[model samples]
Target: MKFLGSLYRFSSSWVGTICIVLFIILFVAQAFVIPSGSMRVTLLEGDFLFVKKFSYGIPTPHIPFIEVPVAPDSDGDGHLFQGKRPQRGDIVVFRYPKDEKIHYVKRNFAVGGDEVIFDLDNFYLRPNEGDEFIEQNYDKSDIVILNGQKYVKEPYKFKGINYNPHFRNAMRASMLGNLERKSLAMRPIMVAESEKVYEYGSVKFNAFYIKVPQDEFFMIGDNRNNSGDSRYWGTVPYRLIVGKPWFTYFSIDPDKKIRWERIGRFIDTLQSDESLIYEQK
Candidate 1:
């Protein structure tokens, strides 16, 4: 009888140890399935990506259930593990500014102290003390010049049955033939002057100039028209950043047709080092 009791205790202890280890791993490094198309081409709606926790740094530990009491008037922000700093063009997963519980993924377009401007539908970045803006190409359609100046606009056509041509094209190639002819329309224009203005698609409004705070980042999705990013919410604090995606582990269509080609593919940061020369005033 004693031997059986000892065996039970040993089994219980082993199970507890295994469970603790699993929890740590899941908290630090794990995979997540994307449910929204905000990231689109870079991260598909149904793609599964692996995130390494230590990629950035050790994360601050949060009390499991109770809040720990610290010194009065103490800045007790709970980040424990220190990690590497995030750079421009990195795909980062972070907590939504509005709701800390909700997580979002976007490419880091500009870091703090970087003057980012979107004119003529082109994104330009100029670091502090930098002479000129570094122009990078996001999409061919993102470039739209109005009266010799740049602006951002959303262009859409009713070429597909679902009202979204790009999405339909991704689903079925044969559906291209079934597309009915329709008029193409351009959304409102948004220009960057003293402040940032959003005048296109679902999110349209004039927003004030945002100075990215220290250790903060500006994130945007490649799918500009569909994504709600820094232009909508705000800057993402460095401490809230989760991790950078390394590779795609799985991609499945609703039809159960797996995109074998996309699997194991690395996420590419859409950026270029080439110099852009434009006639200046």
Candidate 2:
């Protein structure tokens, strides 16, 4: 009877210790999860990734057993740890600016002092000189086909207001049924421009001409037309960058089949040319 009591006490102590260690790791070391497909191709819908917390420094410590209402400082302003500056093309996970409780992930595109512009399906990055846009091609196959014909789908620039041909067609088809000739003649007028624009696909507008301040980054998803990124919410502050994803630990399809081939895949750096991988495949 004495031996049994001793064994139970030992087990209880070990379990408590394990729980405390796990809490610390999750709080200060790493966090793992299956993120939304907002970063598809680069990060899949059901893919699991590990986010390193310490790559950047830790924030100000709140009083033990009591949550502090003040904003935590990750910069060296007076914090215990000072984070490194984020670089372009680095995949980072951070607290959403609109709602700090929500977490988001995106690839860094531009840093502070950079000017950005989008014209005719291209992205331009300008620092001091005029806008230098980069051409991006969206695969037409990703578009939904209707009636066995190539619908002139319009790629959406932002949300709420339909900018692409596909959205107009969908709205027309839904309202008038089968897109009649009469309905096509009365198509809605497209606004020339607006004072402020949503990031890409959402209806929220904060400001225009995002003059990225020091220690700030502009992030976007690889899936341009389908992603809600810096184009939507504004730039993310550098202190929010959790860390770069290192590897794909697990992947599973909705059908319950484990994706064995993707289990050990290494996440490519932002500067890595995606064309090379596509070519190899």
Candidate 3:
């Protein structure tokens, strides 16, 4: 009884409180804020959410704000305790591969061994499971034959996944420029030998293709056209994956108006509820 009382007193102390909070932030959940419209409708700018740190296992703990790793990547996999990889279609928060100091959130479009194709606007995926799995799993209308292989059109089927028809290649020049420099992982290839080249502004290119490297994931933002993602950079390796979003603790619009309806909502609820989906004007 005496020992229990002393332990309680210690826990209530300021130093103990700080330690407890740090423990939660490091291994349980960490606070994250949406800084861009890349996740749009699903996760908006100014939305403050908790990232479930252990969702994919215990990643190398970083000191918040400073973003310094608590320990070196001992295993080189970035996890102190190895965990399962993020599943296809999961919304993930990961450290940007190019700059580990930055964090990026996007949907896991395809996993290792899968193939991806991005045209001017359309996104197609060929899962590693092969054609039979594609035929059995996806709607017939969503399936398309590309170069003798079966690919699914817009396979994610999420309400927030937007393909704004009016939004043209805002990045056509830059994208084509990246292609020229071989900076982008995807390569431009004609869907067919005689297929006419598609033009955006003065830049012209056919569709792009990439095979997700082993133990890596291809990520794409829900706001398709405007997102700077795997299609522009490359697949994200397992080492950089952080965690999944937990729930929105607070949300405010650009004008600083509180989003009363969004607060306290779980990310799963926000993502799956079509009524909450923003209809592009």
Candidate 4:
């Protein structure tokens, strides 16, 4: 009885409180806010969410603002405890490769060893056949037989994925682009590791065929044409993966309007049911 009392007193002290909070933030959950439209129609801008850090693995905790590692990665993969890697079609949060200091969130479009081909806005994915699930359940319309192999289209099957073709590459000419070149008005371009030849939209564009490197993943935004993702920045290494968005504790609109329906909602719950999130007005 005396030992239990002492232990309780220690846990309630400031040092113990700090350790407990830090452990939750580092290993269990971390807060992340959506700052861009890249994941729009699924995860909107201003959605304040918590990332379940352990969804992938328990990574070495960094001192929050400074981003300095608190300890060395014993597993050599930045994770303190080895866990499952992000699977296809999961919304992943990770440190951006070009700038490890910054965090980025994007859907896992393709994982290591997969081949991705794109012509303008349309996509063709040739997943590594090693994943039997892809060979078994991938949509029929998207699959094409070529030289005794099969390829899938818009391969990521996340229901909220925006495949609306009418949304044009006009953004490269307007707000999204800062350059003053003719290519700005042309179709979207993806400079993949490998190149395929194709033309679209009278722009005579060269297609991109990327082979995702081992231990890396190719990320794409659900808002396809509008996002600057793997097409521009390249694939993400597993070492940089942080976690998956767990829930939206709070959400707001550009005009500071409170989104009542979205408050305290889980991302997976919203994704599973389409009819709930649309504006009632």
Candidate 5:
């Protein structure tokens, strides 16, 4: 009884309070702010939210501000305890593969062994389970056939995924340039056995294809046209996955008005409530 009393006193002290806060920040939930329009309507710039760190497992806790990993990734997989992987259409927050210090949020487009086609700034997915699987799961109207294989076209449209058509020509040029630079796995090819035509001072191809490697995931932002994602840099390994957005604590637009309606709303609720989704003007 005496020992319990002493422990309770210590916990109520300032130093102990600080420790408790750090523990929560490291393993429970950490605060993050959306710094860019990469996620657009789903997550806007200046929105502050908490990230559920335990959602995908406890990644090695990093010191908060400086963003230094507190413990070495001894097993080199980046997790202290392994957990479930992110599924298709899930919005995920992860460390940028090239730079661990940077955090990026994007939707999981496809998973391991899945084939993806990028044509004219749109995405088509052929799941790893193959043709019959696509036919069984997706609506017939949404499926497109290329080279006798079925691909789901713009599968996440209901999730508010969109790209700017005005940027199509520029995006195509960028895609071809990235392919040539070999930064990502996108390779130009004529699907459905069509002939290649020349345009933009290079071979005009039907589409770019990439097969997601086992245990890796392809990520693309909801704001498709503007996001720098796996399409440009390649798939993300499970190790870099950080967590899921929990809830918006505060939001402010560029005009500096407090967005009272957004605060206290859970991420899941915001995603499913279509009326609340921002419509592009």
Candidate 6:
């Protein structure tokens, strides 16, 4: 009772309440609003969600809005605590690799030592020794045994992953090259360093094969066709990862109609729709 009373009294005070809220936002959980349509159908433009800050680790506390650093990085890894790093299939909320102040939410498609290939308008991933997992879990049709290695097609079975039907069964050009990241992935002339390239017949042309370096992750949006993801940008360092989104506390459409069904729904729950389940075979 005494501890409770003390906490209550502290929180009732202006400075104490502000500090408590800052502590929650910094170390525990933080409210994040979806600001773009990149993750549409799964997380919408107006969806309101809370980021589980401790999901990865406790980042260096920053003052709200102003974003001024409040403390020194203890481990020199941008986190106060080192926790589990991101893995494949995790929906990650992260600082934009290009701009740390900007936050972005994308599905972690590939992690370190993984080879990601975007070819022929299809997404293919060669996990580091991923063949064993594919052989065990994926349908044979979805697993392509190519050049004595295994590749999985669209391993993430999220229903929100939408592709125009016409875009499928189509030949697409692909180009990828070295990542020159200083503070972030530096972008110059993309074609200058592209050694591996393929030509295809279509206005829709995208090609590249890049290896996710150690301590980096590849992110892609659920709205594949409309999103600007690692395809256009570059891989994200684990230090840049902030947390995982927990749930939708509120959601509204462009017209401002409340999406009653989405309120209080878990992100994983929204993704686990049976209709979204994919065998691809």
- Relative to the true structure, how large is the alpha-carbon lDDT of every model? 0.54, 0.51, 0.87, 0.75, 0.84, 0.74
Writing each residue's lDDT as its tens digit, candidate 2 over 1-281 gives 99999777765897867766655654454445556645655566666666665556654433322324245464434235676766655677776777655567777767886655433243444443222221123334433222232221333222221123333344323323312333211122212332333343332432223446677888876555455666555788765565666666887766878767667566663124353122100
TM-score of each: 0.59, 0.57, 0.93, 0.82, 0.92, 0.81
Q: TM-score of the candidate numbered 6?
A: 0.81
lDDT of 6: 0.74
Which of the two candidates, 2 or 5, achieves a greater lDDT against the reference? 5
Order of candidates by TM-score, top first?
Answer: 3, 5, 4, 6, 1, 2
Clashing pairs in 2: 124-133, 154-164, 154-165, 154-166, 158-200, 199-231, 199-232
In candidate 6, which residue pairs get closer than 3 Å at backbone N, Cα or C atoms, i.e. clash? 174-207, 175-207
Worst 10 residues of 2 by lDDT: 183-192
Best by lDDT: 3
Q: What is the lDDT of candidate 1?
A: 0.54
lDDT of 6 by residue, 71-183 (tens): 99766687888889998999999988678888899999999999776653567788886768668877777776443567887888877776644424321211222222222
In candidate 6, stretches whose alpha carbon ends up further than 4 angstroms from where it belongs are 1-4, 165-206, 274-281
Candidate 5 local lDDT, 172-250, one digit each (tens): 7777777677775677777864454435446666887889998889998887777788888889999999999999999
Provide backbone clash counts, one per model.
Answer: 10, 7, 0, 0, 0, 2
The CA lDDT at 178 in model 2 is: 16
| Candidate 3 lDDT, 1-281, residue by residue in tens | 99999888888999889989999999999899999888887778999999999989899999998899998886799999889999999999999988888999999999999999887678899999998999899999999877778899898877898866545567565577787777988988778633668664555558889999999999988988778899888999999999999999999988999989889999988898987776765
lDDT for residue 51 in candidate 1, whole number 0-100: 70
Error of 4 at 264 (Å): 1.5
